[model samples]
Target chain A: MSTLFSGQLLFAALVVGSIYVLIALGLNLVFGTMRLLDAAHGDIVMLGAYTSFWLFTLSGMSPLLSMLVAGALSAGFGAAIYYGLFRRLLANTQLSQRLEGNSLLLFFGISIILQNVAALCFDTTPRAYTYLDGIIRFGNVAMTGNRIAVLIIAAVLCAAAFLFLRFHIYGLAIKALIQHRQAAAVVGVNIERIQLLSFAIGFGLAGLAGSLLSMTEQITPFMGFPFTVAGFVTVILGGLGNLTRGMAAGMFLGFVEIYGVALTSPSLHSVLIYGVFIVVLFLQSQGLLGRRPS
Target chain B: MQPVPIRTSLIFVAVIGAASFLPQFGSEYVVAVALSFAMWVALAQSWTVLCGMTGYGSFGHAAFYGMGAYVQVLTWGTLSPWLSVPLAGLVSCLFALAAGYPALKVRGPYFVMLTFGLAEFLKFSIIGIEATLGQFSRLIIGAPSPNALYLAMLGLAAAATLITYVVSNSRFGYGLRAIREEEQAAETIGIPVARYKLTAFGLSAFIPGMVGAVMAMRLSYFEPSQAFDALISFNIVVMAMIGGSDDARGPLLGALFLIGLSELLWARAPQVYMIVLGALLVFFVLFAPQGLAKQLFGGARRRAT
Candidate 1:
């Protein structure tokens, strides 16, 4: 009701939205370019959280230090998955008719594997790290330092990624692949390596987001799928593989969730998110900022 | 390919028939597992009917299953579950018909996302309703009767399979296949693309809706989290694909193998069972992406006819 609470809500949305964008950006890269609907992307995010959680607890590393470890771990896993699993799938384009179903099922399988593995390894306990304990107040408004840090990190990474994709040579290659994979291949763009890099980077970003999440929420093995839904929604709402659009949508979803849950009641948040999610899928399949793949 | 051998059809019928009479020869536990197998078959086959034939992989076909279960929960104290079961299917039918319009428009890979989104929307809606009420009050239709539930599920499964068999062998089936292969081409060739997809979607929804209702009756209690569990979607999609979505027999065998294995292994270590299943799904996708029926009987036997 109060303007101060709304300011607080706006701040919460920015912080949460920033993390959501970070989580989904990697998904947009891999999904937009490679065209694999990596259902396990969310699990990768969860694994990233686990990686940092274990490091912070056992090794007594700071949050910032553990974020790099999580990123590396997830990137390695992504590259390994590409070579061990996805590489074979991409090779089997001969069966053409079954290609789409096969890739989807494969990712779903990976999701199942990762979820159970995390459950076994981490024991399904919801965990959080207390690196930043106090709130930063502005006038009548206050926001947690953890959230502020997450926002800064997420925003900076998103901007850097935006520039990297728009101007960098590898980013150009990724864009070429997204626009016309066959043409890109014919032009000798080294499709495999670029795809591998993109997959690793995408997963690394997801892990980074997960690392950020561990500072704020209770991390759990079960958390990945919903986050998968979140990441998927953000990526789609942002227009398949458009990272900037995904970021914008993530920010939008965060506000709906924060205000919808905090204002009226907490239980309505899922409905609000999913309702908006489905409606958006119907209303703007092309995404808020995306032009059709054509 | 040589008049399409009748032998496979006969064998398919025999499997369904034997399953129908399973309760007579098997123990209570066997009956229970058999019913579970039947439910999976129906779920997988219905999914196969819409997605497999049309080339759209639905990541959240569990929407119908949850709808059926919730329908029972809503009507528990008033109507008999047996009566509510068919209505559950009707509700699912309406939902699919309503959703299929917008959902079917989601081109290419996004189809999976759209379906998944819709299912999640339903799930959250249920949860929202529960939260607003602040409790998951039990809504029992009657006494918990496993035997009747098993028989009912068997019938629904049998019906689902029969419907699939009919669809696969019919002109409509051919239309669905054409759409799967190339929607634009099918549209150009004068197939009513919308009608075919919608009908297939409706067909797929009917049986699972009923099965979900029966599952709720068996559970004796209902909660949004439990009834609309995302695993229902995951398991059905995994089994269908791993078993071979291209044909009915393939997924039937797949659903049986998986449902049976989980029954055996899940008794002690549920996590281990899931891990093994996940590994198999990945292995199957990588190595043997072909359906078992095609592996055994051979693929798309058109032979350029």
Candidate 2:
């Protein structure tokens, strides 16, 4: 009985944590590499969920297939954003001057646009994949098959992303740009191309997370707002400019949220997550995994 | 020396005079919307102080505003909005002082992100506390007369404008401008960079906090979600950017224009309002980056040159 109970609790935490990790990883990649505070990251997650839902409902496609389609569509959208907005802004500007003033205004505007467009296209009704059903049980513990699948996918993606960043040429180029953009450009790195690829990959991950979330939970157009808060908190707790730290923080946050819900009201879960972030921020001004200020 | 533009003064006076009498002419709905606009203007001006002049873009003014509303609602209810509202502002200033101490150490996007995190933290805390306390949907305590609340808000708005005006001309303002221009240079020149930033942040929090209290009274309700809505923060930032960050009149004009536009758009096509707002922001950033205020006044500065 004890073993089963522990397993159930651990599985629950892992499942919740995986979703947060997926979202945080995307945000961390974007912020870490590009130094762009894309507030639209959460919206991308939201759009992905909606797209997947529509695909499943309208075309009767398998949820897994829809997830891939949604991710691809979101990646394309992210690339367009890079080309249309960020690239134009970065062109003819120095690196230090690139991140200030109007960039914030531009992204924020894009967020608003995406949010309203989602609302218009999909009415403000919460959606879910109803076909994916049947709870799987191991002794006293129980969870949906979809939840189990989501966990596996999340684990694979996390490992894949880590390996790619550590070993892949494109990932190395991204890291180079992040460390020093001008120097990277000086060394013959195509900074703009890397930026587009980085954004697409980051946003694509968010989309994939969104699709997974919709499998187990309901989706809403405005859900992006809460997720934005969550993603930022997770990334902050993990440390800026560190993907590994972000993943760890996401898992920690997931467990915290689950335990908080179990111990207290579910409503307080978000509050507890945020409270922990605040405490961590106070303790180390640079964040949990960030280096000391220069 | 030529008198400071009678045409501008006259226009201001006429606008204020007309606004003061609007409650009498309009229906309850119109009055409510106008009052909301007034609240937005106050909030935008508050944001402009830190973001526009001081070069610290706060992505969390709504937190301070929500704090002000919460403090007032928890303590005084809506019985005496005139007194309670300013108290809310005071509370917000104190909170800003405390939060800004550690946050202001970072610069650029980091500072903005920090503020955003703090705001989200505050919002979540409010919701969590409210849920357990069973006060999640509590309405504002007292049902004060709307007329009185309206007048009080107007007074608060005027006071906020005056404060901004004073800050724009004062030595502190000069220091803030110095810090905004170049923090390292300001530090080299013996200006207290951190202290000035904290003071500006506190003052920025003060106006929105007060306006929020007034809003609580006018609406006579308080919910965590509504109080700490991120949309409020977005709208204030947009309005401030659109109007002009540097001048006192900029935020006011921006707030009025955006609020008016929101009303018209919402009435015509509620779903598309966000899209229009988004497009407008992009347009302004790419084209009129200096804002409408600068565009109107900038030409004069050039002509004089």
Candidate 3:
């Protein structure tokens, strides 16, 4: 490929990778901290995209502002799901044994419901907006202003998340819960509040990523499925519950997919991404940065 | 040993007898639906043998099904359906054995994830091969007659049911159950946990492969997307879980229930069927974790009680 094409592809890869990093971060937080596998995380992402899309289309709001709205809404929805669905199931000892399987079916059903609702509302036609069509030129290479903005947002979010987790009281509480739920509870941590906050923030991150993705790509009801798979793969590659590792793995996957597409056919990008995942899993079952369970 | 209950024996006989004569009296459309339901029942039961009894949640069964479909397609073009279908099952069983060997080393969630990855990998490989090789020139497979296909499927389903019944009562079945309950304990008790798990996997794969082969023959077409769809795998698992994975009759009931539900919903409200199915799954996971079979069978009646 020419230098310009290569540069454009690299930039695209970074932007896409950043979105994955954002979503993976959220997934890692929820799954890592609560020890609950939320299969509906992708549906939350789709909700964010559709929410932003509708807002921009109906009220002439900027995508960035719409993203904030979407994030808040998703947080509310996440908390609601935790209270209404997960909490009840978590109470049952026999049910918890098959929680993963149950969660898969449960969230998958929710996903289908959300998708159908979107389809009924949006008419199943893929829609796009020209909110971020401007391009910034650097030498012979050109980059979309929207992409650059997304990269900046992603970087800021990642940095903010890292700082929050490392320094903040609530962040530490979340981590404490992840390490030892019983001990954290014994040490006067409100386990319920922490779980609610973590799930809300996790979903909020997914919503943010979804809004950013929609600015670059067309919005469809079924968009969540692929992104969910991508998020899952990233989490697995990064080591199940490690946030930093998930982000690193997401970026690694994004670059691999982008470069792999450029080198060969774009169709094989999934194969390449999943191929790396299988290899990583085979070699190190826990993943690159996943902690071994005691 | 407890004698086989007359009530249970009579129920089994009645169901089989009804199933055997279904094609003769049922309308063409009814027969078609019944055959389709039977096909899913077979696939679901196959999955139950491994996932329910052995505790190996193989998410890559679509790969085995796809392999069986392709094998049938490859053979039926040149050979007879009778010969090709069994060959498909054998091929799938071999593949399951090979794939399960490495996977059985891992336990719990890791095993599930690996199987999921393998299924996706197989889907990609099939699509890649189809793209690389011209679709028209690569393979030319003929379809079998629907009537013959229906009867063959019925026979296969019966055989699968019988095999499941035999295994559920056999020494091997006890070993499989032990592994499912506690792998370490089973190993300590000399249950050959790995071997029994592999055997379950192989049998599971074989049944689906055989059914998939018949399905391909009935459909008269085969493609990667159709053959290796993750949704098929999901549906089979859901059916087994819904009907009661632990019981032999559970998957069959689950399949029939889902098929009837899908057909009714699709006819009345095509868009809402999926939503309803999803809602039921979630509800069942939360409220009725034991599955329908457990509900029907009364949660394995304690002998003393």
Candidate 4:
């Protein structure tokens, strides 16, 4: 009990929570901007993990460099998906209003295709690469170098994205679109370009998270589903489309997960997290940070 | 709410009648395929009853299916499958009765995510329960023959379709559709919006529960993960979409087409089959969101209107 409540557990929770922030950010962005659920978000994460994994295994490139490459590639793929699939759906005026439901199914299909294709291409075996395996020790807590790297990189990526969304012209444009779609368009925002960009960035972030995740955990083709669920939970907890609040929610969930597992057992990890998900949904559908719609 | 056209009814009965004799003359492999066909038909039809009509699409039907399988497994020795199967349905119906109230409170995408999260929650909880009990997996020895299982699945398929048929034409289904089109309006018009949705959800759950029970015995294996596989839910939604969930006939057609396609490709190249299914889902949503059944029979309904 004492060890479970130690500084080590707290640090571990922060590390895991940082990863959640990465996953949720991308999810909320797409949902916020275009009202697309992006059910394939998890599969995009898997693609990123594979991208980093293969890059390391085949060419001995450091995962640190490959994470960026993975993010870039996934961004490209995301843009292509938008152009090929979602753009057409968005074009139909009748469909655009119901785009959330339509995109949910469309992305669900995309996820299935992505998962199966990855499984076929990579096989279902879990793969891992040896990175910085050495452990670093502080006064009382020891942490693996890989996990430490993951945390730092994830934090850096998240902060960069936060600043971009906060201060950049395009970031403000994206925020404007989310806040008022008609008004943003009336004010000269390029709905199509902004939508495409946001979609790509959302996917790219998931991909980047996957790469960082690959450093700390073994990567599998099917690994994205859990992250997808986690990301969605985080998104909901923070209130959809509220990025800063989502980050806080991710960390909060991370603490809850780690401490909950410590209190119970590791096998009950999913149960505890989903319990929180259900309770949050039932008790507060608007999310903890979201204001009730007038 | 009009009665199902006599032509559709005749076709349904004829196809089911032909399928009923399958176990008697068909090979074991044929029986197996037919069993899968029936299972999907049952699943897709029931899914249509609530999700298709009420427009409350669920990604959590797997929870009920898995629950049914779990119930059947628990009752395996004490009760015969004849008893266990209905018991599985009852258990799942009760689960829906309990879960539907809060679950139905959310609408659209929130409803979708909540249902999906609930299913995953149930899956993991079962996994934890099994782990705590020290039972990693359970094997059912001396399970029913494929022929028997096939018969049971075929019955469930027929029963599920019949239920959908009855519901789609009933006032209850009209209320459900009204809820779909506008829940607030439906309530204003004196429909018990909450009660209607909840009943439709529970009704939709019952058949899948039975199907899951029959499938568990057909495989003679039961594991929490396999029982609660999310792919099962995805497949059900895909079938419903492809078939057109507006009525019973659409899902029936969708099942036949996909099952036929799977029959051709699954054993030879399963990956290709999945890729094709995924591609079809995207294509249909993009090109023919009304579904194949609507394309074929949609004309008649429109003409009548």
Candidate 5:
């Protein structure tokens, strides 16, 4: 493992991690502030893929337009979930501790629905957009132009979201809410509005990631569940609700995953990733960069 | 179980007796249907014991099921079919032992995510193993006769039901229920929260493992996607949830209902089945999160009588 930490692997990790970052930050925002786990997040990414694929398939539109369209659509879906499912749960739930538990069921249901519907519409076979077929080389290493595009898009979006949380008026409120919801409320933050905003932003980012994913990977209705699970792992690695840390952790995980895939037999790739996840969990349950104990 | 009224006991006996003897009277199709229903009952019951009762929600229980199937397929060439169940159960129990401590250290969504991740990890590891061995070719095994398989599944289901019945009525069940209601308070009041949770999780994984192995034998093959699918966990979770998890009978009823519904959809409109399942799940989560049993039968509150 130590010997594998060369620049190439590190660079590969960065690219892979950036791909992960496209969706994880959104999950982090919702998980961190609202404590809602939105397990359907990966499905949103899958939808983004479809959005791009369909845009190309039907209208011959550019992937960039598809990205924006996907982002908007997913944000709408996220808002719908918040208003239709989450808002009801939040209002009905008496105990703060049990909210996420109850909400998880809703998200699970949503994920199922999303998968089945997408399957019905698109079928289960993987769908990939016919684009970004070029590669860029540096030194002795070569990477796909699609991978670079995904990396740049993911980083830029992550930075934009991080900045929003840092400097935007609503961003400060969200930050305050994540740090201390009760205090944030006392300080006159509109908690519900901000929560909805965060939720929408998270979904929007997921959608964006999905569009970017069209250029890099296969898409399927069922692809979301695994990514959602991995996203959760990323969230835990960076500490729950710690958005920026999630970025770093996402990269770290990408490195681990890429290197794990590289070092082990093809089948053992997932094993190595999971093995690392469990080990890290046992060593520091709080995550490498998380502030609060999950 | 409390000393039941003779009528209720008689009803129970009659129902199970009819089910156990179902293969004798029906075609192989009936046997197959019964087998699937029974498997769901067993899997859902095993899952509900820890997740439903404890409220920890083991979202990835299918991992145990998949692992059990994997273990069975790997070792079944030498071992007897009956023996594989216990072996798989033991292996899955051990995995729960290893994962539970680290996983249960967190609560709420984190716990759910950890369980989900563990299952995903198992799924990937299986895929990795398959890739390494280049064993994409299907396993060719002497599958049990449909009748024998049906009977075996019925037995497993009965065992699962019995386990849930006993556990739900026992002191251990009470402690688990306490944990579900409020863990920190339960710990403060001396519930041995961690120990109880681990025990619950281990117990939950065992029957599913057994059921998974049985499924492998029944299916006569073990593919990574089909065997270790995370969707199985989702189905079991949905079943446990929709039927309600507050009572021993919840999972049984839920599994029967969903499996029956699935069979119907599978027969008439296989494509629409998942769409319907998704719709039902959303409906249940939003409108009936207490599950149908809780809403219809007045579950735990009514159980006291």
Candidate 6:
């Protein structure tokens, strides 16, 4: 039991939690802004991983560099999806419930398209690459250099995203839109532009997370769904659209999952995570940090 | 919800009666195709009972189906499938009854996520249980013949459609539609919102459970992962959406259309079938939000809002 709370487990929890936060950040952005749940968000993550994979396999470019490339490419894709698909859906405000319902189905369709396309283009077999595969030890706990890199880079990116959303003018505009879409539009916040920007950024973060994930794990066309589930769980836990709270919840989920698995069995990790998700949902449908309706 | 016309009801009976003869005269391939058609129709129509009626949009019918499959597999040999298949439906109904309280608490996207999460939770829990038991997969020996299974599935399909048809016309179904149109308003008007939703949820889960059991028996194999495949849930939603979930006839049209399309494409290139299906979902939502049955057969034009 003592070993369950060891520094090794704690470090592992943080590393895994960082990935959850990375993916959830994008989900939070899109859901917060558009009130649309992008079910294909994880597919974007898979695309980014594949992009980084091919970049490395073809040109030997470092994943660190390709991570940015993946982000840019995913952002472009996100913008295209918003423009071509979701724009009209968002135009009408009267069908708010229908909007969420339509978008959910729409994204479900997009996810199917993305998964099949990837499978056809790149066969269903798993792919992997070796980068920074060295050992790093801090006293009694030893970690892979790639994992440590994932930690540092994930932390830096998360902090940068947080600061941008907190302090930037565009960030404020996005927040305003999230808080009150009509009011924000009336106050001169360009609804279309902010929606597109946040959509792109949300997708970009997913791509970035995918690239980082490629450093530590095998990549497959089907890998994105689990991450998508994790991202959704985190966003739900923090209350839908609550970014900072989502991030914290992601980390909290990580600890629970890792420690829970450590105490039980590795195969039960999903059970633990989803058990927590269902419980949180039933107990606090408003989300862990969300205020109760008076 | 309009009343079903006698002529349409007669036509449905004639079509199903004709279909029941396929196993005796149709080739093996034809029987297989018919079986798949019946399975989807059963699954999709049941889904329409809850999700389409209430606008809850559950992404977890796979859980019910999977639960049914698991139950069938566990009870194989010990119990006759005659008893087991309906037992599967009973178990799934009870599961729905248990899960409905928390599940129905949230609306729209939250409902989608919670249902999805619940399915995943069940899937992983089953996987874990299988691992602990050191059984990665289970196989059914001496499973029923395809003809028997096909007949069973066809009955389930007819039953599901009948239930949907009945619900659409009944006061119970009106309550469901009322909830869908405006839950708060419906409750204000003295509709038993909670009870209606729970009953609809449970009712919807029952047929899919039987479908899953029959499908597992047909395959003669059961693995937790395959049984609980999320794609089953996705395909159910897509079929419901494409066929239009508002009426019994919509799911029938949808099941046939998609099954026909899949038969043509999946034989040559499965990837193309998937891509087309996804594109079809987007196209239908954007252009034909009312679905094929509604457009073809003519029904209440979708309330624009």
Per-candidate RMSD vs. true structure?
Answer: 3.1, 3.7, 2.9, 2.5, 3.2, 2.2
lDDT of 4 by residue, B81-179 (tens): 889999999999999989998789888877887888899899999998898899999988889878888889999999998998898889997888888
Candidate 2 residue lDDT tens string, A1-294: 354347777898999899889888887777766676677778888998888788888988877888898889988988988888777666635422635445656777888888889889888888777755788998767888898989999999999998888899998887777677788899988977888888899899999988888888888888886677678778777776667878988898878777777777666766676677566656455543576212
Report lDDT (Cα) of residue A87, candidate 5. 82
Model 6 stretches astray by more than 4 angstroms: A93-97, A286-294, B1-4, B301-305
DockQ of each: 0.55, 0.46, 0.54, 0.59, 0.44, 0.63
Q: Please give the lDDT score at residue A281 for candidate 4.
A: 77
Report model 2's TM-score to 2 decimal places.
0.89
TM-score for chain B considered on its own, for each of the candidates: 0.91, 0.90, 0.91, 0.94, 0.94, 0.96
Q: Per TM-score, what order, best first?
A: 6, 4, 3, 1, 5, 2
Which stretches of model 2 miss by more than 4 angstroms? A1-5, A92-104, A280-288, A292-294, B1-34, B75-80, B140-144, B299-305
Cα lDDT tens digits for candidate 5, B216-243: 8888888977887777877887787678
DockQ, structure candidate 5: 0.44
Pairs in steric clash, model 5: A26-A202, A32-A241, A267-B128, A268-B128
Q: Judged by lDDT relative to the true structure, which candidate is superior, 2 or 3?
A: 3
DockQ: which candidate is best? Answer: 6
Clashing pairs in 4: none
Stretches of candidate 3 exceeding 4 Å from the true structure: A1-6, A284-289, B1-14, B136-142, B301-305
Query: Distance from true position, residue A20, model 5, in Å?
Result: 2.1
Looking at model 3, residue A103 earns an lDDT score of 62
lDDT of each: 0.80, 0.78, 0.79, 0.87, 0.79, 0.88
TM-score of each: 0.92, 0.89, 0.94, 0.95, 0.91, 0.95
Q: In model 3 chain A, which range of ten residues has the least summed lDDT?
A: A285-294
Provide the global lDDT of candidate 6 against the true structure. 0.88
- Clashes by residue pair, model 1: A26-A202
Residue B116 miss distance in model 3 (angstroms): 2.6
Q: Top lDDT: which candidate number? A: 6
lDDT of 1 by residue, A12-41 (tens): 888878877887888878877777777888
Report, to 2 decimal places, the DockQ of model 3: 0.54
B71-186, model 6: which lDDT tens digit per residue?
A: 99999999998799999999999999999976898877778878988998999999988988999999999998999999999999999999998998888888888888888999
